[model samples]
Target: MRYLVRDRMLAFHEEAWVETEHRQRLFKVNRKLLRLRTTFDFVDTEGRQMASIVKKALTFHHTILIKQDGENVGRISKRKFRIFGDRYKVTLRGGRRLRIAGNLWDREFDIADDSGTLAHISRRWFTIRDAYAIDVMSEPDWLLLVILAVCVDHIIEDREGEQLTNL
Candidate 1:
């Protein structure tokens, strides 16, 4: 599957079966790095986990872009770790079953299915504080761009009352 998160994009594929296995690969790009950790878990509607299959961590590096309202923001270097198999037969606690196939790019991620359709993308930004405990510059300027992109895409997709959830 394929999806665009901000200026970043990712794609994945899975086999048709009750369960599948995925191999994790690592890469690096300049000063940026990615450590992707994949896992399988049964979760409830509240996102609580029921069971988890832990895997190894895949470390890599890549270039990432962060933009807000089509404007460029700051950038970040990141690494990814895959904690489980790339392929999984996820059985949600709600009785919904699906194959989880996706990857993480720094603070952004794209998850998709067999048809190369995006299920979701996530972006995050953090605030940094100093010795005086004063709020300093916000971390990950690109996160704002990612959030804006997701919001715009959500509006275009018109999922109806779908609210953005902070990670």
Candidate 2:
């Protein structure tokens, strides 16, 4: 399966959606702001809650917990001391772990398991809007992968906004 993840350009907070190649909406991602904690809500096309990504504060590296139906499903944490580029350690449901590495600035990256590649994400596929493509390679955990993609996007956006403020 493949999906297109796009951010709302004019929105005040982080809001995005996942769409099919033909532009059919698949999931809606909503980020909660002005709250005690950071949380991202992922809802299906039919408006049912799918998962919640909650940020865990006060960590040496960025860490987030992926929850579904109030149960912890996964964890996403940044890899530290990378001199070359950014990398992430993703712990999916059932304790399956994967490493994500590539050029986050260009929005081109891949997730790989011990066996092989699982998903490829790139922005070069589209130039019209702030969107990226996720190509899932026969992966049954596509939903978790998409949510992780959005989580990475949120981290990048927050970092960019911080840079702008410091300028």
Candidate 3:
């Protein structure tokens, strides 16, 4: 399964769409504004909340929690200290671990575990600028794959913002 993720910068708040390859909208990535913690809600086409990617506050390393039905289904956290490219860890509630590795800053990477690659996030499609598609290989975890891609994007943006300073 492949899904297109497009940023809607023109909106009053941060917003985006998770759509099908043919451009059929599947989910709306709505950023919640004026909140203590950074958050984004993934809503289905029928206006139902599918899941939420919430930035965990007061943490040393960047961490985003994926919640479904108010339960922590999975988590994406930046791994501390790496000699080469940046690395992230995805932990599922089931105690399974997946690692995100590759040119994450460029949005080209792979989400995989000990078993194998779960999904591939890339810009090879290049339909829209800053837009990327997640080619999900595992059928059962498609939602997790889609939401994981967005969580990676959010973490990257957050790190970039933290690097700036007023001098």
The model with the greatest TM-score is 3
Arrange candidates by TM-score, highest first: which order?
3, 2, 1
lDDT score, candidate 1: 0.27
CA lDDT of each candidate? 0.27, 0.85, 0.89
How well does each candidate superpose onto the true structure, as a TM-score?
A: 0.20, 0.91, 0.93
Mark the regions of model 3 whose C-alpha exceeds 4 Å error after superposition.
none
Worst 10 residues of 3 by lDDT: 158-167
Q: What does the lDDT read for residue 39 in candidate 2? A: 95
Q: Candidate 3 on 38-143: residue-level lDDT in tens?
A: 9999999999999998997888878899999999999899855567889999899989999998897777999999999999999877967768999999989999
Q: Clashing residue pairs, candidate 2?
A: none
Q: Which candidate should be chosen as best, given lDDT against the real structure?
A: 3
Residue-level error in angstroms, candidate 3, position 2: 1.2
Off by over 4 Å in 1: 1-49, 56-105, 125-167
Per-residue lDDT for 1-167 in model 2, tens only?
88999888889998888999889998888999988778999999889999999987667788889999999998989854568789999987777898888889887889888998888988887875589999998468788888888888777777788789999
List RMSD in Å for every model shown: 21.2, 1.7, 1.6
